[model samples]
Target: MANSAPASVWRNPIHFLAFGLGSGAVPKAPGTFGTLAAVPFFLLLQNLSDVQYAIMLVVTSLVGIYLCGKTSKDLGVHDHSGIVWDEFVGYWITMWMAPAGWFYIVLGFVLFRLFDILKPWPISWIDKNVHGGFGIMLDDILAGLMSFVVLQALVRFVF
Candidate 1:
């Protein structure tokens, strides 16, 4: 199926990034596609020192607020399914300093997606009650943080 976004929307760099390099435009499972698009970024940052990695996540999250907010307004949709920059940053957050190799990456991906889609507790509350760019980013941020906690625990205790 064709992308639901307007033609002019792609002209804006913010919208493009917010769409996860067009992966978000996918007709099905855009969030999954966006999360997949994030894998490369996670790999690139894999070797950085913890401080540097943290800085990168902070920068991306800050920028994602504007990106997602603007794109949502432009599309006249709140938290549109195609707006997946949140997924990109969320996946990165979930994978931060995760174990090396494909297994860990896949595990991180699954965990992140699970929390993101499920939107438990604070995530659900934020998704329902918050507004604007920060709101769009907040739920996914919590989901990422939650996934990180679970992944870390599993790595430490189960695996």
Candidate 2:
């Protein structure tokens, strides 16, 4: 079940970001909403050069650790379902070096969501055992990377 959004999500700036600019507050499928919210930002980032995009991925992922951790701490929750800055970073990772088109964007979204939701192998293991903000971010990071590999392959071979 989805954890309800804390009141601070609106009042606190950090919490607001952790909650994916309020996208995570939805009653159902907050993660999906959060990922969806990331699409626009991804579109904007597409303008950047590959190196710039990679830098953004690293910076956002690093900031997400603190944002998610601090918000979770403030709310006394461990990786609250409402905290979704990680989703933004994860989606960004999945789109790295992707072709410039809506088709690839949609495909990256689907692939990233699949890897994130399925939690295969080590991702599941890490999600189970890890704790705190880094733990929360790590699993999605893996999901994005796994998605990245597959998306790249599809671009290379099939699409």
Number of the top candidate by TM-score?
2
Off by over 4 Å in 2: none
- Candidate 2 Cα deviation (angstroms), residue 86: 0.7
Report the alpha-carbon TM-score of model 2 versus the true structure: 0.97
47-77, model 1: which lDDT tens digit per residue?
9998898999999999999998998887788
- Provide the TM-score for each candidate, comma-separated: 0.95, 0.97
Clash pairs detected, candidate 1? none
Q: Give the TM-score of candidate 1.
A: 0.95
The local distance difference test score of model 2 is 0.93
Candidate 2, residues 54-148, lDDT tens digits: the string is 99999999999999999989888888898889888999999999999999999999999999889998999998899889999999999999999
Candidate 1: count the clashes: 0
